[model samples]
Target: MTAMEQGGTGMAGARRLRQPAARPTWLPPGSIAFCLRSWAAVMLALGAAFWLQIDSPASAGVTVMILSQPLRGQILSKALYRMAGTLAGAVVAIGLVAAFGQDRIMFLGGVALWLGLCVVLGTLARDFRAYGALLAGYTVAIIGIGCIDRPEDVFTVAIFRVSAIMIGIVSIAIVNDVTGSPTAWHRLAAGLRRGAAEVGQIAHDAVNGRATPDDGAWLDLAARIMALTSQVSFARTELADSALRMTGARSAMVAMLDMISCSRAIGGVLPAGAVRPAILAAVRRRFGDGTPFADEDAARQALNDLLHAAPADAPPTPAEAYLIERTMALLSYGRWVRDGIRTLEEGRAAPRVARDVRIARQQDPVLALLNGAPVMTGFAAAALICVLGGLPGTTTTLLQVATILTLSITTFDTRAFGIGALVGVPLSTVCAMVLDTRILPYGSGLPFLALMLAPVIFAGCLLLIHPRLMPVGLNFGVFFFIVLGLDNVHNYDPTQFVDRNLHYMLSAVILFFALTLAPPSARRRRFRIASAVATTLRRQFIGRGDIASPALISRQYDRLLQARTWTGHLPRKPATLRVFDRIVSLGDLNGALARARRHLARAAAIPAVAGQVARTQAMLRALHGPDAAGRLLDQAAHLLAAAGHLPPADRETLLGAVSGLFGAARLLDRNARALRHYGILPPPEAAP
Candidate 1:
């Protein structure tokens, strides 16, 4: 159908039909090609499943539908997860059935606990890893729920389900690989270039005093770069050379991020002066006014010249020295970017770059536990209703409901899927009804069924690949076919079909309420995460000096980066920016304190330095009540300075601790909201 003709279906349908971006001239329209490939793969899988006489041949099609993705890497990653989740789920199902087969209540309770645990675990993982957790969560329901009448058949059901999924996965993999869908390396290259250009522009701007980089934007971009590192393995599977190219791309991306951080660090320390302006002009002249540096050699040459011209008699101050080093680091950073791009282009190994400090992620077990409440409650309610109402053959429907919720649980936005199911499931049901009652005869063979079903499958897959349409399209399309429950031996009873759909509809309703009524909305989830991050930083700062491990702080920063990415669409001006800066300041303080503590330990034989360390530690511990932050910071600084008579290395450590203390104090004074969040003085406006 023409785009216009397809869109005429209505607003919701039109949204599904709308492609987010136009396809390239060199490539066939990707959606059309993807749709066709997916249809063919599903057909092959279905044929294989039916020919082999698997119990649920339609599951083969569902598998294909689930695995259909536009990129080769996405398909591979998803297929791997599908296999892992299926296997894990099957194993758990067998255990659950074995343990409590005699007591339906016990079995149901066990299933709910298992599903909840999976949901909790899934929320802790990132991206498709989370999907795997969700898949494992509901796969238990799919296997165990259906076998409730005969627990002995759970193993058989698990095997058939896994076998059908494997067939679909293998079919799609072979087709997608042979069809030459774009490799992950191409996307990796694009990501590298984009990140380099962005960081380069920010560096260029900082030199010229045009604009400082936005903390949120920088963190969001860094998080995206970090995310790309995970896709490297997926790229290697696409082609032999992709591994080398992707590795180089990843190195370059990390170096670019470090460059941004260095630039920000220098900007924070250096005051605007004649030297600063001269350096900015030299950088602007070399990098060409806010564009990516095109000539690494010339840029390096210019920066070297600028460094050499520094007056020998000029006062050697820490800030000026740091600025000079930052400039040199920027030059080195640009060269790495250049080498990385060249490596990707030539399919060669990238030069090794220093690994940036890994971002840290801290999980709130409370949040994870809360995340599962909806999934667990939904399953429990569905089971209770099924048992209490004595609804025969409705267990499968409850499983579907739990499966939908389990899938939705890992997403940043759960309501989208819940809403998608409400629309997609019923839409699919209608389409299935039309095909069964009007178009296809009661006893069509496999080939005939594939022929008649091609359009539906094709259209569904088309929508599945559309970026804007994915949630609705996939949910609607897959569930539509699944709820229809087509079989090798056709039982085209309209009453049965209608009855199944009603149960499916009811399932969707339960999921909708579960997601809507219990779990936090997207904004709320973001806020909770952000709050947790702020709270974590506060605790680290006030707690024992040793609490801030490099690894632990890295995780907290990583979580902050994730929060920044999630809330990128939030307006730039707000407490969000202030809060983020404070969190980062705390992180820096934690690291600095850790470094100083290590140095102080080496010099602890000196009684004076040891005494000063003890004093700072006491004040830090007392940093709790309102107005304590500023007072404790001042006291810590005094105690830090009292170590001046210590060995040179220990004195340096004391200086570093003082510097970190000053940074925390500045953050509190500058951002009143941040201070208030940490139980400091009243906010700026409210201060008497």
Candidate 2:
């Protein structure tokens, strides 16, 4: 009945006391795309776009642009660079072919060398920053390999390729704009609301001293919310339109993220004892009393009124100063997002806001450098193919390679490296056979082909409904179709087509290997594991009240969360959050480990072991707040070393003691034994 009371309730009582989950209309949006879905959508879109031409259509690149828009600004950014690189490479090819006649083998050799450099560039690219550089290099390959004997026709193809690329960019941008585009404000608003709800739930659980499986789920939910918060800030800064739509969207989204962040921070500080009764009452209503705060008529009415319009009453309670501070921050981001949308609708440029928005910018200079590295390599590769491989057509070959490589850089997914290789080879031959050999000479084929290709109209209208893939997938499919005309393998020796495809495939694969292995994977997996500790702690701390406050559990999780951002080179995607979740689960395992040690130590009546568990809990509390961790972890280490000399069955005891302590060190600070690789943890000053 009161905060201090306890009941000898079994699991049956717990379940009976628990309220059913709220919301009768809560239809799940389902999950994000699986690897298979991503693969299929990409292949499907390309098949549809390039059914007419054996030489790939730029439409594939463009479609990737539209489909990738949900990832913030990256999708279009990739397309833009690829288009530029393809055009530049095409023009350069025209010049090279014109200066040297098709009869000269040396001229073709130069082209092959140039394309090799492009592959290296693609290899170095971390993200879209390297896309253009890769494009510049591959441009040589497309030109060299595809143009072959009809060197004079390089100019005509170059012009057409550029035109096709423009069509693709426009198509993606327009389709994105028309399809009730996901405004920054909408996303930000949703994230803020979600974050706020999490804070509320966490505070209620914290005060009432309750922990449930849902709490663990909630922690995962919170980490994801942080990701959305990051997105809101990015929108406020990175949006291109600069119109009312963009401004309004950014404003609203920013407001929501900032507000909820502040609100949660304050709510986290509330003492567990203060709000316990009110929470139990709410839970009781949801179960026995048939009324819950969030779901009941009274609380829902109060919430609706509060949100329906800002209250005209005096300022909030002192308990809510933090909440109001959070509210103001939320309002700022919300307003910016709202203003952006309105600005877009009005067809106006940005109208200055009362205050400036702060942007966290770390546009890596290294990414640009890495992107540039491939140019020299690509040129060398291009030169080789031109001379030794006898690619009479250098420019078109180089153009295709450059464009595809550039387009592929949009995704951070490791697997996509292979897609670039598989897509480019056969498509290169197909384009060479159909457009290079068959269509232009007849002159009659061009008009008919153009008419037949007009089905781009349907693709344009239903771009969103088509298969979804990373930008690279669509690029590969389109290029595969584009270069390989519709069923023309028989015209050339089927083996020759296959052989050439394999050759180019090897070339692309070689390029991919070159680019990626250059820097190696930086090996950030450990850091991800560390950051997961923090996320897990937050979830356990906020949601699980029944579980005793095991400090090492908290410490281990905090360490995981803290390790998340230590990778000095920040990536554009939210994919890193997945790594954090995995590591945090490991933190949960550590808790079980500590509990087992506690049972064993209590049985043995080892004061040293008892001291170690206490110290471990102390370390966990300090994990959340730096100052509190002092001397606790050291004691854990000392106790474990003492336990190490015990008997064989005592192996579990000694191992648990040492392993748990080591895990604690990993969680506590970057300089700690386990986290030394991160190299950014501050000296253990207490958290303010």
Candidate 3:
């Protein structure tokens, strides 16, 4: 099934475009209880209809379906949200009718007021939570303000629509539950493992600079991963995976994004060798389960010696040691989380390794504004269409808008919900005209058509559950019912309805395009890349330290691996992905350079190696930065590259050559700095 989801706003955000893999062995004819949830839903829907004075079974069905979205938790939340929105909208609708039934001008004010409030709510909400607020605003437009002239029928129509949604929700819930369909929670956890593993695997490819399948693979997979993540994140409180994993994945994602941005500015830089071999090895070895740590005592003993290592009288001395220590801490945490899982607290408990990243508004307001343009444009179009509908009364306006928004959200496969709705509404009108006008056999056939459609309804229900394609089918189902409910059904013209819906679609598309075309407010791509560089720097400087102790080294490599995995996940604009690729390479370069620095630092400690190593380190620092470091790296690369290959130099000498940037970057941090300190900043080849 095509997994539709929220927009891909973050750098390398979720992958909505990928086709879901073949179903695992655990699927097919469901259990008996699957029917129970739907049964309950039907009861609840009927009760709601009775209490709210809703007039039709169709209205009840809509209500049931709206609330019966598989996940009991989400189902309940939606139910509450729907109820609150309906009640609130009904009150406002009643007020508008009381005030504006007398004045057309006042009705517009009411419509504007309700929508503005929904917009406000949408702005603050995250994930599915925003839907309710959006619905609240629209419901008022659909039920109250749209039918301003027909004040008396407001409650009846409103009640009816709510009832219909309830009925649909109930029917589906009972059917689903009785069939023993998998719960969202199980899917959520399963998705995390699959997503995380895939993240690790694909990221390893990018990190190692493997060019095949590439970002397209990740991109195809990311949307669904994210959508699943969101679903799992919000599934029952029992669910425990951080929507964002705690460790390097966060930083990796950030760096990848930054790298992408930086490359855009610089152009065509691929980090073909940026990935650490250890990362690829690790990704391949573990898949998504994470590295086996055995137990805490084992982990502690492994880290004990590494943690005690003191700074040496050499380049990268302090930095490498620090890198070693930080990595150990993270590894221990991962082991801790793993142990918790072994105990079966699964979703109910969290592992100590749960290094969930802080979802900060990493970008400023300007960036946020840029990203929001698409959604805002969608809203604007919705408003204009309402004004243009020119329906006779508020009731007609309310019903159509409800149908429109619901249908609008259905075209997720095409990545344009607004456009989808526009297309769907007309299709619905045609279906309505065809079935209600052309085919129905007077009064006797009405019930018979509904009964015959039971099978079609079942099939549509199956399709509606799909993550991606469901919206299209769901829209069709509701529209099918909506048309049957229209009183002037027999006289309806399918062509005219289609024409109106097409324009409705235009409004949605205009909004979508407007938003998509707007400049991104945040440079998430830049952060992802920068973070990647940082991870590499940390690991490379600590090079060889891990070798002295496999466990400690494995832990450190794990952190680097984690970061690399997520960096690839940051949102990817076309411009950003290229930048990200370069950053990945740069990240590898940074790691390699750090290892060089560590060698220099250690090599300098040798009795006969001191002077040469110091010189190498000094030269390297000079070449790598504006000061000494920049010059040093430049000299080494120039010297080495010119020599036709790496020269067989002393380990200390190579280390010194690479630590130059480390020194300069350190100095820059200690003092306001730039890379232009020419006097002291000389490359190995150029240094006096």
Candidate 4:
């Protein structure tokens, strides 16, 4: 061989040595673990059901699939609620059979009304609580409609259904506990820590005037905080001292929201120049990285330094005073965030100040009623069709309709639920066909049956783990078991399979039309949220707002968060964006007024300022029109001048009250156009 050839061979050898080893595809360990646990629970449930000789052994398997969750806490909590819902529904089912068993029309009508009421309640709830409400609705359908032909057997069927659900719940709980699955509290704690850091960063940026996050960013942060509320509830089922831990978690969430409000207010009043204030530099150094103070003394000392950083010789301008008030509030809330996190970690009570602060939730009765209408109407129509057609599987079709409608009530996108059912039913039917004919026929025992079912369950589990594919996976997993129709005596009939699945598909198509015909309007939701905010502001303008600062601010935050959620779903039109921005500004104005009232109540104790406080309250009640903002500024100035003769502490309190009023006036001027548009103020006059 020539030298060139030898050199080429050496280079190839080097390349071969540098190449990495080939490996099989990677799967998430958590997903695999969850799948194995779920599969084991399903097998156990099936074995128990078979031994008991239940009427519908397949229902047990369906229950296990429905209750499957990654976290042990979620599974157990949901199982509890599911059992409660099942029992409540069973009781109602028995009553309906006794009262209207002789009249089919009355029985069906009663079922529809019960389902409608459940849907409305479910729409108003959150998390597993909502699931419980929805489950109660459909359980009535399952029991009452399943026994329409044999009303005498209603009680028997109800007993068997509840038994199957109990078996499934116990199986999953045992499996999860033996496997030592992850706890929700651990995950929630980590999330709370991460959220505190993120919100701290936002506060730091606001103080330094470094960044101004858009509406989307702020809204995203708010959503994360709102989501934690559900997690806190779930975590309560996992620990002994859950009440204390949950109290701390609630405080942390409330503080984070208050911190965001302060950050936004500070951003608006921050000096335009690039030069940062000395106190701001102190704030950035202390909390820029989001680390909480170690103790109360440390937090107090740090805050004291921040307050003294402002010049004592000269009084602050209106904007400067506002900035100082917001900064102080930011630091105090940040300390509360730290304390709350510590309480969660150590499983102790939160500080007394934060223990009483509750996060308020937004409720819309009109929206709930609107959501119930579609479900009720769809059920009525489906019942008419099934009764009129008088087909072989008409009863089964009505059951499917009730299930789909009740389940879809909890989901934001009903169309997706329909689409998932449409695609999943056929796929599940085909898989059941192949499995029944080729696989299950060759198996004779429970072990062999579980072995054959493993791959199908695993595939469904993989899809279920993905967020985007969850709806499809849910439908596939649930319908596969139902369509398979597993029992003590396996009758593999191809015709029965095809006929049953056709009815299921028909129900999905009906759901699609029912949901799409008059879907909940995004524009209408936006208008309602805006109207709510305007009503709140109008009440505040007339001195009818809540007196407690925490309650007032918490309620305002809830409304603003709801607005942010709906606005994201609307088309990104300029007008819509403007309306959302105006809503946020209004929230800030609301907060400023709340804080002003709190401080005014304090300043009222001083005899020197009592007369001025009375006049200011009267003026606030009569506030309106485009010129109302100017009058507010004038009144705030007068109050400040009157307090100049007081001592330092009293004068400082008076200044806080005046500063809040000034900030409110400025915000009112900025949002005057929106105020008129929402009918909170008189509309502009036409030109002469």
Candidate 5:
């Protein structure tokens, strides 16, 4: 059966149709279980804090809420980083207080500089590690600024904050473990299997020449796998067999990338008449047959037999030979995918896949430094307002404002997140008053409080799962509990509650105005991000690095994905899509160049082939410089065309590589000119 037919009806088809499980009223799915467990842990931490007579129990509560993510492993990992950041920030706060305690101007200036540096570092680090940098940055603001009036109490406040955070972390880890929260290993396995299936399908499509290899699906898959690495680290700490599982899952990710590269290569080389029905049948069976091939050896032998035995109506040519070579590479990568799955499923270590090629993400240091400006300016402005207003109890609220703005603005659109806070604070304030005055006043036990909280907590957890509603849910949920201020000694003062709510609302407003002033518009942000990707692509072509070919290609694809997501919200303009397509095309050509270089490493009978290969590399480097990129490309094409005319019998091996180079260079030249139209490539200086 063909791949389409194989994907059809009944019990077999049910596996492909993934529907969300029907959630019952009483029971929670795995993710919600995580949320529920986190709430319980926070409550327990609060109890411990109160029992021990900690000065600020609310700090512990906030720590637990911030560390709470859907995945247990992520929570565990983040908790560790949070503690490290807290300790580091405490040290810095103590030192800063000692150096500039008496000089208010110097102290505030030092704090601003520190916050700006952290934001810059966070922007440079793109993954989970960025969280650690951000936490460290804002922690100093939280602790140092809070202790400005009483420098002597800096040590005492730092001790209390660290101790409380530790209690919360330990509590959450214990509760999550005891409650059997879903493990990260299972998530990793699911992602690997899904990726393998996708690679298989893409391979099948490529063999039939029905593939658009540069589409977004492959980029999404790569991004998902990259995002899972932190979770995998957490899983290794929890499950003993997780180390082997991580290896296998990682191999599967790399193999999927390899399959994509090979698919494009084969698609380019395979002639219209070269691929027969038998070849397509074999590919379909290999991918969708619903049965394992027993081993890589068996799968290879079967593919070999199909290729050798299939009828070819046309005479042999260079394209047909190249097709066979790339087909072999495709089958080899497909087998790796199978072995990786087997290894993950059976808890056996798979053979090591060579990933010596490092993927380098190019970040513009200047832009990163500039991105820190808005964040720092907003923070500085908030501090200035609070110091000048000179209102009692405003210091605490101002610290909260600075903390929220610094963290949120770094990761998201400043205005949008501030707006979410603006909407969420009032809703939470009303809920807090009703629960504290109306519901909890008559009750006197922990059980009554838990019962009252269940509904609100459940609702928040439900909203957190929705993509669009998450910001609102998080802002409301976290601030709601803080506003309630549940304590051992209940103080039912309506006036105090009203006053506190007003301060919070005012603080959020101050932050909103601070962020909105001279904000980067959506159009500008999209343009900058797209330009960054283009700049990175250029660097990849010109700069010599040890990055792996597959990884390099995958990183470029991921950047383009980010750019595409941004452009989706902008006005529909063909120039954006056209520029994106050119980047995609250029990336493919670069990959082809890398592969051609590797082919030249093997001995060839014709010496002239090596010279053509070197010439192509030089042309690619010149294209990177954007100086006469089109002219250099034409020169490379001439060299390849001359090499193509060499005697076919003696230069059989070199001729295929030569033809590949000529095609890729011509495509690169066309894309470079398109990029010039958008001013991505350096424009020619106006004629003097």
Candidate 6:
């Protein structure tokens, strides 16, 4: 009786284990809502365009697809830029058409040149601003080149195009409002708070001399922090008091950068067990909860006490002085972090202590030119082929090429964009074909059309939400409406469908080849960024770099973040790792020099301190070996001794200057070997 029962029971249990767990609702609520919102916008756009009898009802739907963002703020912000870009491009298109209407070749060349210029600008810009530049570039191709045969209708075409885009924008806005879509400010505030906590932990760990994070970890964290640059911009459009909120956000970002730099500097100079236990405990208790200090004055006093807590019997070493300096910095910046989050949450004016910070972006003219040249060359070549080939729909083919190249410049990985196009356009074509011939043919009326579109729009939105699938989803979502060939009157001809698909596929192939020929080189970019860091360090060594300010700190963070991002794209080789390390060291050195100069400026009024500071600055200009570092440390100690005679505020300021000198010497010693290898520091024999 037991053997048969046990065997049956075991088999049943196995079957139960093999069964899937209810699939756990494959799509998240947010994604599902996004998909539904996008589909509704598309429908409303198309319906309005068709009712108005616009020349390109499909464009309205395409606009909706392109503007599909999860946050209402993003959609509104992008929509504003899109409208501006379209209007600007349309005006240029009219002028180009008027000047070269009788000369098609000249007209195409003019459009290509305009496209190239826009690509360059787009490459230089960031966030939605870049999108605007790219859109303006392609809009000319859509408006001017599109009317090569019907030059007289260029104005009419521009008007219709603008009209369709307006329809799309209005449709999306209404749908978003009706749906009560999420705001960017809410998400941004949450992200800022979370980032503050993580950064606070890093600083706390560094001050307490815990296991410090590696270079890559710090870089990664910086990148994450820098990414909020775009969110801050988007969130500015979400509220009426956006200026104040953005000010706070910017302050928070700057503070976070300062905190990281201090953390890295402290970790490098302050050895384990250097800080007194009581000071360490105070630091731990302050940051333990990951919240801003309740009282700024009280916190500053507490930190100041820790700075003086070193026994009177034993004078503070260079490491101890630097620790105190960075700890004080942590307190001040930590207050800004708290104030910024509060402003963002409550939509109030940020505290007067919170300075408005702007994160700088690195612009490489060489990289921008590299990105623009291929786009221009590819567009011209495609235009030439289309013009000479004299194909029935060559204009459409050229348009596709122009659009793809212009859009590709906005992305970091042109090859991935090309691949996405290669896969997405055809998939879109196939779906469009099936929908047109099989699905739409069996159905009629607007409701039926909307029903047929729902699933495809939903699928594209679903994929768009995923990072890996975003490129493909973006191409598919935008091109599906374009390829579907929807019009005021439906045309069910298979020949036209095949011809249009072939044109788009040809353009996709061209994009793939163009990008493959001169793909953006991650290795080259990494090297270039490293070279930039070295150059900045060279300037710092010569006392020519910008003084440490919010702006300077923000720029340093940007460059380091860019290096880290590019390094991730490269193969994990020892040489690459060394370059990355060298870049970080150079950056830290530059920050040290800048901070030293700033502190020197603050305390320069004191004649004795001024003379010593001047000598230390002279030594930095010839920074070379450990001998130089040791001498610099001696000078810093002298500066610290002078600090005791000043008032409390002046004393703290002088201490910071001394600490900066100490930090600089320590970094020079630590990275001396690598600096020598990179020619940033001279070898022992070359030392003056």
* Candidate lDDT (C-alpha), each: 0.65, 0.41, 0.43, 0.77, 0.62, 0.79
Global Cα lDDT for candidate 1? 0.65
421-492 in candidate 5: lDDT tens per residue? 777767778888998789888886656766787777666666556655666666777777677766556578
Off by over 4 Å in 6: 1-26, 272-300, 350-353, 617-627, 673-688
Point out the worst 10-residue segment of candidate 4 by lDDT: 1-10
| Per-residue alpha-carbon lDDT of candidate 2 for residues 1-688, written as tens digits (9 for 90 to 100) | 0001111212432242244665532122211222223233333343444553533454354344333445334435566666777776777677677777555556555554555455455544434435566566556446644565677667666665565565555545555454434455456555555544544443333223343223234334434543553454334433554434444433433333332232233233243222233333332232221112222243333322332232335322212222222222233333444444345345364442313333222223344344444544554554456457665334444444454444444444424454445543444445555553555345443245444333332222223223333233353444444444333222444554554444455456545654455432323434434544444444332222123122332333334433443332446355655554435434544453343244334424554455555555444433433432234345444554454344433433443344334333333432233222332222346221
Backbone collision count in every prediction?
A: 6, 117, 125, 0, 2, 0
TM-score of 2: 0.45
Q: Return the top candidate by TM-score.
A: 6
Candidate 3 lDDT over residue span 205-260, tens digit each: 33223332333444344344334434533454323453333232332322222222
RMSD of each: 9.2, 16.0, 12.2, 10.4, 6.3, 9.1
* Residues 166-227 of candidate 4: C-alpha lDDT, one tens digit per residue: 99999999999999999998888998887887788777767666554555566567677778
Once fitted onto the true fold, the runs of candidate 1 whose alpha carbons sit more than 4 angstroms away are 1-29, 213-220, 239-247, 265-314, 338-348, 354-362, 442-447, 521-557, 565-688
lDDT of 4 at 362: 66
Clashing pairs for model 1 are 359-554, 360-554, 360-555, 360-556, 361-555, 424-476
Error of 4 at 465 (Å): 2.4
Candidate 1, residue 583: lDDT: 50
Cα lDDT for residue 361, model 5? Answer: 52
Task: Please state the error at residue 70 of candidate 2 in Å.
Answer: 8.5
lDDT of 6 by residue, 1-688 (tens): 0000000011222232233535444386698899999999999999999999999799999999999999988998999999999999999999999999999888888998899889999988988889999999999999988898899999999999999999999999999999999998888888888778777877776666565566656666677788888888888887888888888888888888888777766665455455666555655555454455566566556556665666677656666677666766776788888888887788786563365466777778888887788888999899888878878878888888899889987677888888988988988999999998888888788899888999999999987887767789988999999999899998898887897778888888887888667788888887778787788787776667777877777777788788877888988899888777667667777777788888787787777577776776677666766576788788888887777666667777788788778767766777777776778765556545
The weakest ten consecutive residues by lDDT in model 3 span 1-10
Q: Global lDDT for candidate 5?
A: 0.62
The ten-residue window of minimal lDDT in model 6 covers 1-10
Q: Rank the candidates by lDDT, best first.
A: 6, 4, 1, 5, 3, 2
Decide which is better by TM-score, 1 or 5: 5
Question: What TM-score, computed on C-alpha atoms, does each candidate reach?
Answer: 0.78, 0.45, 0.56, 0.89, 0.81, 0.91
